[model samples]
Target: MLTDLPIRKIIHIDMDAFYASVEQMDNPDLKGKPIAVGGGGKRGVISAASYEARKFGVKSAMSGNLAAKLCPDLIFVKTNFDRYIEISKKIRKIFFDYTDLVEPLSLDEAYLDVTKNKKGNPSASKIAEEIRARILNEIGLTASAGISINKFIAKVASDYNKPNGQKTVNPEEVIAFLEQLDIRKFYGVGKVTAEKMYQKGIFTGLDLKQKSIDYLDKHFGKSGHYYYHVVRGIHNSEVKPNRIRKSLAAERTFSENLSSEVFMLEKLEQIANEVSRRLNKSKVAGKTVTLKIKYSDFTLQTRSKTLPYFISDRNILLETAKDLLFQETLNNSVRLLGISISNLNIELSKKSEQKSVSVQLKFEF
Candidate 1:
């Protein structure tokens, strides 16, 4: 089974404070200044903060009120997702030039399987350098990259050098790299899982490697199987290109809290229509429809209903969203409304997909 697994060269590219960086590049006055991209009101949450703002404890998802207290001079710039999306497409184009085996985690980060690249470059390190350099030269932005044998290590190494740097973990150094990594730093280990591992004396990768698979299975259940191999630098997940989007959604925050269910239903209708339009444009339908509601007190609630058949009809989506909205009693006045559809069938027409793609040669582990 081990010999059947493939050995791959993976590179993870991540933009540093992407939104904030974009803001700085557009407005020279904001350069080197502490800034955040998001609403900066009493109830607003930050979407991203510049490196300068980070020193003041301002971070993404932090409440605007708290961020203000952390840094009095923190400038809050409203998020321009349209602009960000445009920039992201350009970056993806650059990745495609090197290899089509690229998986975007978000607009700011992606994983590339560059073992066999279009440039025929044997060195993955050199490819990463060229990619980063092109981004800086053409796009006027900086990116950091990590190179390794798998996704997990590549992701972790990408964070080792921030702002503008890259790290490569050679095949021979994989074991030592994993052994010395902190448990908290390992991918998939969240706060609760980290605390649980620390309680069990599993503070580092080495400590985690010492546990028997059966012992870990007893304590951690299904995740035990994953940790058992990750600790030994063994991850066989493939870099899937053109990954299907799981869901599509549209949401809007009201300037004032709404009290009437009739007004709320009207908002849901518009949101559902937008979601329907997006679904059709993508040529995908979903079985699950989710309604997300945010109350005036900043509390959020989500309700979903799965249909027996896939649908992209506006009427069906609006009716379903209305049902989900009225199914539960309003605990408080609503401040935001959103509608999303998931469990998508994203198989596109054969003619739409690009042809003559180069296939990467697989290597036995």
Candidate 2:
């Protein structure tokens, strides 16, 4: 461990095939079956798949037709966001029992800072074990976890033993653990980026560490610096709680591209309504509105404006998106559009406001 950097006790929790597992739990007929949670028709995308389906390489974001071809008996269940959100809230309540420094990555995953928790637990490993057990006992769902000195390592370690398991990277093991890890397993290194790293002779974390910071910066740009530090187990991103929502957003991907402003307006209004609804659900309003455009060629662009006061009305959101939409001409036909509101009015609690992270390297997380 680097003496200069602070040691934190972070845990990343990920639900095992969350959507598919929920389907199995709710409908016993789907139990122990190869299930894909999403549409099965043409133009359908698999949102999630069960471990049973995973044996045949069926996975999330896979084309429905291809998934069927791979697993002939794959059962498709419709996506149920309402049920998923309801279950997610229950899981979050469980987290608060130990600590309030819970940062939810999504409905199925979160990062919790257990360095100083309500339970006064010293062992993050035990905390993780108990949390997983409680989820299985109380909610009837299995969750996996990783405990380590920081969020990046915790996130990576969570996948070591999956489907209701946990791994802890002790303070002494952090460096060696990272060195042996495959570059492909690194959180931010996707297929394309991994290929780029491979071309630079960076197949593992050890290989990544061998390169000079300058060399990595030349090849990977801004992310080069990120790769340089994280391989040394030095990611310092904190587990910001739910009270700190930076923005509220809603987006939709179109089956057909919108070729003109006239066609785009109809879809933009719908997205604005969703953004407005989410803001109200959180009981917050924003002063800035941003219009995100994804062109048919897959390029992304955004136009934003800050308002004089916060607003959450759908009409106000629609009008703001409209103004930004007309601010610039289309570079290409848009295949996706989104509306986001930022600079929120989510006042932090006094207790949360007073909280701060402090580190002690001797603690066994």
Question: What TM-score, over all chains together, does every model reach?
Answer: 0.88, 0.86
Best by TM-score: 1
At residue 317, candidate 1 shows an lDDT of 96
Q: List candidate 2 segments past 4 Å from native.
A: 255-260, 294-310, 323-335, 343-362
Compared with the true structure, all predictions reach lDDT values of: 0.89, 0.90
Weakest 10 consecutive residues of candidate 2 by summed lDDT = 352-361
Write model 1 residue lDDT over 1-365, tens digit each, in one string.
Answer: 22333567899999989999999999999999999999577678889999999999999989888999999999999999999999999999999999999999999999999988899988888999999999999999999999987898899999989979999987767778888999999999999999999999999999999999999999999999999988887777778887768899999888679998898877888888899999999999999999999998889999999999999999999999989988979889998999999988876534443223222333211
CA lDDT for candidate 2: 0.90
- Residue pairs whose backbone atoms clash in candidate 2: none
Highest-lDDT candidate: 2
Per-residue lDDT of 65 in model 2? 86
Candidate 1 residue runs with Cα over 4 Å from true position: 1-5, 253-260, 294-300, 331-336, 347-365
Worst 10 residues of 1 by lDDT: 356-365
